[model samples]
Target: MTITVILGAQWGDEGKGKLVDGQCQEAQLCARAAGGNNAGHLVRVNGVSYSFHLLPSGLINPTCLNFIGSGVVFHVPSFFSELAELEAKGLSAVHDRILVSDRVNVLLDLHVAVDGLEERELGDAAIGTTRRGIGPCYQTSRARTGIKMTDVFYPDLFEQKVRRLADGYQKRFGELFEYDIEAELARFNEYRETLPKYVVDGVSFMRSAQESNANIVIEGANALMLDADYGSYPFVTSSSTTLAGIIGGLTLNPKNITETVGVVKAYTTRVGAGAFKTEDTEEIGTKLQEIGREWGTSTRRRRRCGWLDLVVVKYSNSINYYTSLNLTKLDVLDTFETIKIAIAYTIGGEELDSYPADLNILNQAEVVYHEMPGWQKPTTNARTYDDLPKEARDYVEYIEKFVGVKIKYIGTGPDRDAMIQRP
Candidate 1:
């Protein structure tokens, strides 16, 4: 069996954890291919909910082997803290299945400081970053001056490298923002000592697993629309969040991938600042926010709610070549009399079939909506496509037709069993 990639098709918060968990039961190895603690995956098991930032969703399944791939950046303290919490809940065994990749970049205290300072400098123009040090770490990684998990074992070398990087950053800070640096170095060393035990060389391990025909699932953080190469620029993540990212991150061949599942919400939601075309500024948006608990899992900030955008979904499907689609949070729209789906966009009176390359264009684009009657009746009892109300089925079909992607699974609630597989 080859690897399968699972990613979000819309602006994140797409219930990727539930979809990953559902498929992980049959997977031998499950790995997180990209992103850092900036992205969160919320999973519910045995009626208890757990929000994971650095850990793979497969950890909840005992039979599966979980790996944090090299493409991720590790915040050691946060990583161990989550591990301890999961252990306290008896969710995972310590030494048996979990593995950390050696090539994974390490996030230092200085990086966090830089992130805060940069964001503060932006002020009103800030992108509303989580300030978790992800962007800075990736920047340093690209510069080839960043530290990795493998460097932790060599204290003297690591300290020297840190000193050199600190000096350069201090010089830049002094010139740009006039900030002090000695205190930052001291704080970074303190954090360095608190890192937990972890193994390296994740690529080799994954290759071996694949050689053994292990059923592997590569999970991506964020979504295609937030990808650095394809997303809304200046507001995008530093790393690749698309299907192509899996190949480079895990050192896997294209032939190793057999299926790609794109997860999306029934409605659209985004945290922080960006161009949101179908945003609802009315009572329905507020109602959806309350019911969905639409908030950033990492920053705890309220998320901007909007109607589903099929134009972006079509773009996502084309980029990822998604084999299946998982639609979540369908129950959040239960109270609405009518639901709107953005079928296309109009800019300067010109109809647009796909997402615009310019962020400004997206900001000014008018959404062309297709209104459908809402299924006010509860769908919690509906376990199959046949069981769903005609209106609800019609809504799903409309989306399938618009996005050119088939809906394979629908999440009716937060529970694990709430997922309905469409035949």
Candidate 2:
């Protein structure tokens, strides 16, 4: 395949990292198309666990070259910090392998601070952002007042833009927005001298790779339910998390996209605040959370757990149109006597054809679930698709039937080799 994409079909933290890492072995190029350090992907290989933020998980494969595309909101501190952590884990020649786009927006510490202030202003209505400066940085980008990665190379122009960005926010929050411009500038003064080596024009880079007929893999950030345009309104993340985002963000040709894999979790989960129709605020939610480790990879917050929502999955399929699916964390339901999958959603006793645009309607929407027998057997060590317990297989198969896409990969555990891949 010339190009392959792995994106979360559910809420974020659907274990897209391990799948991306698996595909990386065959990929000559791996790229992150959008979002920022706010998105986290965890990949475990050879007994070492690597968490990806601003960098692509493809770094795990020494033979692969990774790129951070223009659609991403870049942060200097977090980029170096994540790279250093990965290097400490024994990833060699890290500096020589990755390339970043010059058109990307530079996320500053003030952006992070502004994010916190914005959240505070919302009070009980907060969106629960990662406080990583993603939203604020994107806000500036959209406003055309943001500093680009290319701007960092020129101190005078960089300072002018930084002052412009800071002054705008400073006016908005006044005394509440606290920032030390000179200190931040001093740090960038040092960064400018060393950061240019990894910079590249993203379009030219991608064109050259395609010309060479290189196999490219894109690891999407965030998830479908968090997409800005398609997701649950103000509660969603600031960028596109769909297939279109990858194409636009990477400056990629959609026709070259050979395959798109939707990473579907065994159940539904949401971190922070949003309307969760299938949410079980009772014992079931707790058990699923405990067993599934349903915690946010990016935020580390306890996710609100629920049964598998076909309503959500089917809606995701409608948007991204996956070529295949990967049902992850199946073993989390091994101990349940019964398992539930949400089949449809309704409001005021009327069924909706698809996921609604309004959060209010969704919040009031009642979920109709299909209850079935649980496997009650261990699937953690299943050697193959057939090796999985019959009940487990049934659950996976039923999901495949409902979503109208074959489940190609099944994640039994967190290890790189613990997945069962099907033909």
Candidate 3:
């Protein structure tokens, strides 16, 4: 059972889409293990760029079977829209190879409404949600009142579930925000009817495939730093965004995993608000952002750019048990006069090599940086690591040494062929 897991190691927006698509070429099955439409994976193939939400990166490859595992919260509109876009691109046959987990929860229109309302109410205390109803949907799932894709197959059950959730939310809305629930439910039912057709039982299907020795690639959303449990606390996502999430999300054993590849950008970039140890405020940071196009795929919000934080990378490496690393966007730093990498963190006068569990400590921590000369020569034309300038190679080596992981793949450009495989 050669199962490979690919995920971001930063606060997301780490170019996971390209890495997963590249890896999917070698695997038979590629599965999206977590997150909802709130997470977006952008892939540039043959000069055309495709932005996907609620679809596995593998969908671009017609030969691979893509599975949406139980870990995700389904958003029908976004899923169908993405599918249609892919179809418009002449990849309509992809639907035949994709499957969704029956156990995955569905994100209803009301959930989106309620989530947005709640975030607005929170004001400054809000966790900087995408307002895509991801948090609310997961909350409902844990509350044992969520609607699954299977529920859509049964009209009576689906209606009953919707009514129950709507009734409860309506009462809370009045008490919490003085909003009318009856009107919201009426509108939600109308929207629900327009949802796409989906079958459940993804866990069983994946398990059977595993028994048959199918090569499965578990694609993860977000990154370790955005995980609800271990990430920058209160600012993290609603779900577990780590490799451990796959065990519960897919009901799979850790023993069945063959390899896990953690994807990290050459530098770091994060969306929303959180503790960014290596965040750059100077001209160099702006250059990286522009060159890398560091922006959120779901919200199109400009990302907060920063230098490489080895402290967080090492933390992710330990938690995800990453066997290999796919370092992307290496060419983004080619034109800079110098590149700075955060080697460690100094918290309360003590130099720490690892991330602190306490957000307070993290917020106050000072980064110990190491500056390396940037390569003036262009790397966009370099197809291999050997072809890259010496300074660029040094920067890569610095990251590999500090993070304690081998750089297996380096992305020089946005194109699929722009990736360089390290020897």
In lDDT terms, which candidate is top?
2
CA lDDT of every candidate = 0.83, 0.91, 0.82
- Candidate ranking under lDDT, highest first, comes to 2, 1, 3
Question: Which candidate should be chosen as best, given TM-score against the real structure?
Answer: 2
Candidate 1 wrongly placed segments (more than 4 Å): 175-197
What digit string (tens of lDDT, one per residue) describes model 2 on residues 75-175?
99888988899999999878789999999999999899899999999999999888988999999999888999988998999999999888988999999
The global Cα lDDT (0 to 1) of model 1 is 0.83
| Decreasing TM-score order of the candidates | 2, 1, 3
Provide the lowest-lDDT 10-residue window in model 3.
Answer: 175-184
Q: Any idea how many clashes model 1 has?
A: 0
Error of 3 at 366 (Å): 1.2
Which residue pairs come into collision in candidate 2? Answer: none
The worst-scoring run of ten residues by lDDT in candidate 2 lies at 292-301
Q: Clashes in model 1: which pairs?
A: none
Write the residue-wise lDDT of candidate 3 on 1-423 in tens digits: 688888788888888888788878877888888889988888988878898888888888888888888989988777777888899987758767778887889887778888888887888888788988999999999898898777776767877887788778877776553444466456446645654435547767877878886778888898999998988888889999988997777777788888788899888888877778787778867888888888788899988888888888999998988888888888888778878888889977799757988877888888888888888889984787889989888888877877788888888888988888876
- Residue 271 shift from truth in candidate 3, angstroms: 0.8
